[model samples]
Target: MSVTLVLIDACAASPKESRVQGAVQAVPKTAVHRVVVQVNSDDPVIMKHAITNSLNLLKAYGDRNEAAAVEIVAYGAGVNMFREDTSPVKDLLRFLHATHPDVVFSACGNTIAIMERNEGHPLSLVDGARSVPFGVVRLVELQEAGWSYLRP
Candidate 1:
């Protein structure tokens, strides 16, 4: 199976990112094996969009006859999605965490620190997420490991 990675560098002004990710999930193409959504914005709205988009994508993947493994990696302001307390989109985040095993959510540690300082509390992640050192490096590593990159 081929792996398709969706790199979500933009949090604002892009429904295409979510739509493409959903499309890919619906098909479950052997041409695609893995899909990664990299979020690189700091805006709360952007983070919300990323999480919402990711959940939609995962739902599509689950409904497909075949599906690619999906990972949602958050960095910069996008890291706010993980913070346990400030998550306004808690229901959606929790739903994603509960339903999909192939769906992995990652929060960048460096971004977490910044978020905590700004938000005046410790950063939090959904129960199923892993904390990575850096988002860009993770993307590079995923790409070098043969994942196709799509900036949607």
Candidate 2:
């Protein structure tokens, strides 16, 4: 099985293939594009914008056969963006989960616990959304690790 998909440039020989004449450099998956996005608003408009940006990043990198990871960290009131019940953009979230393999939706574990306690029941996140211990800390860690930060 292939480790990852490679896109061959029809116009030029890839460097990975050979060192012959007119060889062009190949963009290996190892050169990953990373971005951490913050979404702390409960507004649907903001949530949609963040999701759109993530999709765009993934598409741009995918077109070049490069690896990309777009992480959306939802904390505070923004945690509602990932809630299965309260999210206004749950449809879009579900679509992304089904179609976009490179995009991640991260809910704050601390926020989740608080919300659950307030509601007196467990809260379910949108399909494919995962929980992190602390959203802000994760954001800081990602930025420290050289991931581009964006707030939308």
Give me the runs in candidate 2 sitting further than 4 Å from their true place: 1-31
Instruction: Tell me the tens digit of each residue's lDDT in model 1 across 1-152.
Output: 22233332211111112222123222223424556777776565665666666655545654553345556777776666676766655666666655554466778877777766876977557787767778777777667756655443
**Which 10 residues in a row give candidate 2 its minimum summed lDDT?**
12-21
Clashes of 1: 9
Query: What's the TM-score of each model vs. the native?
Result: 0.64, 0.77
RMSD of 1: 11.6
Note the residue pairs that clash in candidate 2.
none
Q: Model 1: how far is 31 from its true place, Å?
A: 9.4
